[model samples]
Target: MSELLAIAGLDCSYGEVQVLHGIGLALAKGEVLCLLGRNGAGKTTTLKAIMGLIPATAGSIRLNGRELTGLPAHEVPKAGVAYVPQGRRLFAEMTVAENIEIGLMARGKGKATRDMVLGLFPRLAERLNQRSGTLSGGEQQMLAMARALCLEPEVLLLDEPTEGLMPSMIEKIRETVSKLRGLGVSTILVEQRVEAVLAVADRVAFIENGRNRETMTAAALRADPAAVKRYVGVG
Candidate 1:
């Protein structure tokens, strides 16, 4: 359970307005860590900062002990970090295969990479030539995840991936996260659903008002609903 990604005393801002203040969390190799907080708690900001989409004003972000604070956004994926942001940003005009190819380009990957990615998401396999915009919401999410997985990333940052999906689709995402963990892909998930997040997370970090409130094992959080109420007023 070595630390694969670490954030210490992290801070971020939007123009002159600060959003994150000394937020800290860590993810172990092959673990699923979920971030839980009320809206505007800077959970998404933490993920973006780690991806270098929004630069960290101060503090440390490291992957396998290599500093990532100053790295360019494009280089972040090359450093083995792939991000699936809140929106499923897809090229509406592109086909399913084309969308995945964009991710392959990140690592100079070829057909073998495509095959493996398709293997993980067989539904996508059936719609390779279909335009991404025409797919269902669940299908779009699969494509977004497939695109990120094409990078063969060690750390996957997922922002509210299950939002607005049906229960069955939600289960599909949960299963995919579990499957990825078995493959040694550590995930930092930003999710608000208490039951769903608890089901997949190895650990959970509570972020309140742009700072770390506490972090505990998922089992501990499940057994103690009061902690959720204290921080987010939800179970």
Candidate 2:
């Protein structure tokens, strides 16, 4: 339960427009932390700032006590942080195998990494040569996560992972996340599906108006439905 990643007094902006204010949270080893909020509540911004996709004007991002703030986006992954963005940003023209290979090559890994991911997602194994653009929505999502996993990251940042998926697909993604947790991969999930995230998260943090409003155990949030409704604006 030692801290794997920590954010404190974080602030970021897109040019003159500030989006995050004094945002802070921490993730323990092998734990899943769900970030909940309404649209434009700075949920995605928080993830991006952690990954150095957006520069932080102030504050600290640390992994195992190493400073990560101000690191370039590419360097962030090298620091053991992998990001699966909101949209499944797979290369449309590339095959499933090709897409997975990109991540492996970036990390100086070879077929062993590819075999590992294919083992986690057997469906992808069957369509290695299939064009990513031709795959269904669920398949695309699976590929995005698989690609990130190929990097063998210490911390995974997922943005709206369940968005636009069917019930069965959502369940599959949920099971995959649970499996990852069991394997001791620490994760920060930014999600709108309250119940889905709550089911997988060890803890939950509510963000509002570009700041962290509250953080509590998932069990606590589930026990207090009123708090969930008040902070998340959803029950």
Candidate 3:
């Protein structure tokens, strides 16, 4: 199958401090690829580069055969990529429904998408009118994800969706992501939760010193946690 998204020889820098180096990735339709690395390993930079949030010093980004390099960040979303950053950035002052409404404001998706996102995360339905800032950590994460889903994106890029949630909430996010895959949404997940990420990912990419150290099937990583630990700073 042709890739939904592809990054080849990607390199990035923060000022003169170089970050990502020769990073490459490909995500097929309905497949989830997880990127694992220790802090400062450039995992987030890879995502930013692909989204055009940060300019790539070198490399190519293609979405479904269209060259995306140098496209403005805003235009990248129009090309069918939706990103949920690490912090679960939500409009704190806005209500849950209002927050999701923000996501569709740019795309002009109608009420049907709202209903779809609500159906996928029923908790958000009950909290529709509630202030998003008051939501617990887990609810906020769901709200963040729900907002992204409202876009009905062809490819989803998630950065640490389970970063600080409790174990139960982590499980909920895991199941939600699994359902997204079942729904045929291709995803690239950058996460710190080793066990949680591996559980849902179809394939794994381990990064070390700003490069792709290895790419293997999820089952292979599960069978050999030690290898991942050595690369990602945890087992």
Candidate 4:
């Protein structure tokens, strides 16, 4: 499992307020690393810094040994890193197909890539012409993931992908994550749904006050229920 993404001495801030402090972690090829923490613990901030959505005051972000820090957010995807942000952020007025096309255009991809994503979320295939805003929450999430996949990224950054949804919808999102892992897509998953994310994650990192507090194998966390509860507040 070669390293796919690495962060060292990461520090980020919003204006005068600092968030992340010397955060560091490494993700391996085809591995799923879940970031577990309570709100304001800097989980989302970590993803933003990785994607260059926010400036990292100091640190290194590398993808496949290529430096990615200081790259603009739009260029991040071209470097084989795609972000599925917390809110899904789909174009409300655009049809499902149109939303996917946007991602294809960004990466200079074509119908082949689009078809591959649709294959992963067959529900999106059925609603290709439907407006994204009109779709259910789960459908929107599927579209979001599908759009991100259109880039054929080497590393996918997922921020609370299962935040607001019913049990069935949560299952669907989990299935998608599992499928991505099976397809050998490396991912950094920021999730509050402990069990669901753990099911697909190979490793887990706990964050507090914007610092990485602990990192261990997912199997180890699963084996020790007390650790899961203490770090993530769920088992």
Stronger candidate by lDDT (1 vs 3): 1
* Cα TM-score of candidate 3: 0.97
Question: Which residue pairs does candidate 2 place in steric collision?
Answer: none
lDDT of 3 by residue, 1-235 (tens): 5788888999899999889889999999989999988888888888888889999999999888999999999988878888999888899999998999988875789899988889989988998899999999999999999888877888888999888889999999899888989888999999887788778999999898889989999899878889776887665
Better of 2 and 4 by lDDT: 2
lDDT by residue for model 1 over 116-156, one digit each (tens)? 88998999999999999999999999999999999999999
Error of 1 at 201 (Å): 0.2
Candidate 1 stretches greater than 4 Å from native: none
Looking at model 1, residue 222 earns an lDDT score of: 76
Clash-forming residue pairs, model 1: none
lDDT of 2 by residue, 1-235 (tens): 5788989999999999999999989999889999988899999999899889899999999999999998888999888999999987999899999999998977887787788889989999999999999999999999999999988999999999999999999999999989998888999999888889778999999999899988889899878867778877766
Looking at model 1, residue 9 earns an lDDT score of 93
Q: Native-vs-model 3 lDDT?
A: 0.88
Q: In order, how many clashes per candidate?
A: 0, 0, 0, 0
Candidate 4 on 104-140: residue-level lDDT in tens? 9888999889888999999999998999999999899
Q: What is the C-alpha lDDT of each candidate?
A: 0.93, 0.91, 0.88, 0.90
Q: After superposition, how far is residue 134 of candidate 2 from its true place, in Å?
A: 0.5
Off by over 4 Å in 2: none
lDDT, model 2: 0.91
Error of 1 at 119 (Å): 1.0
